[model samples]
Target: MTDPARSALMSKVKGKNTRPELIVRQELHALGGRFRLHRKDLPGRPDIVMPSRKLAVFVHGCFWHRHQNCRMASTPKTRQGFWNEKFDANIARDQRNAFDLQQLGWRVEVIWECQTRKREQLSASLKKLLVPPENHR
Candidate 1:
């Protein structure tokens, strides 16, 4: 690939609701769950925000968010240390964000990119999350 192309790819690599996020959002909407998307004021800008239920979801990419023990999360050989540091920071920040949100009384759920690979299962799981505990019983 050309240098400009590589640069463009890196530039577009952001930390936000990507394809997986959109997929989850679509499933949740179909399940009758209404929520906000990427609220900047929120601690982590959660991908899904259900105020009445006080639940926040962070749809994480397995590679970018570093899913522990996941094969797809392996760091690139080139600049290994830099990738490790960045991935570690992402995990730490995710923990801190979830902790802060919980302390403020918001329940947090993390969905991984690998999970999205199993769309049917992920859809069912997301439905479970969206459903109120009382309603489940």
Candidate 2:
């Protein structure tokens, strides 16, 4: 596609409140996970923040975040150099953000877009993550 078309398409990509994010939010809420959205004070402005649990969740897009071994993380045949640099930067920033959050005593979880597609699995995995250690059997 032309540059203008590609730019327009990319512009339409929502940074927050995306479909996958909304799905994760719903699942978390169903599990009685009370949370805040995008806390600016935190590194990476996590998608979901549970202050009581000191947990920060990032809902990452497979393609944008370069989810390893994920089909969604395909590379563009054209603009190879540009895409590589962009993906590398995204990965680096994610690592830095997670490290910073960890240093601040916050537990971080990353929910991939592909993972969100299966609601049952996502809910189960979230339950495990959100459940308190004392409650786990």
TM-score of each: 0.89, 0.96
Task: List candidate 1 stretches off by more than 4 Å.
Answer: 1-5, 133-137
Best by TM-score: 2
- What lDDT, from 0 to 1, does candidate 1 have? 0.87
How would you encode candidate 2's per-residue C-alpha lDDT over 18-101 as one tens digit per residue?
Answer: 999999999999989999999999999999999998889999999999999999999999999999999999999999999999
**What value does the lDDT take at residue 82 in candidate 2?**
97
Candidate 1, position 27, lDDT: 87
lDDT of each: 0.87, 0.96
| Model 2 worst lDDT window (10 residues) | 127-136
lDDT tens digits, residues 18-135, model 1?
8888888888888888999898888988988999888999999989888889999887777779888998899999999999999998989999988988889998898789777568
Best by lDDT: 2
**lDDT of candidate 2 at residue 61, scale 0 to 100:** 99
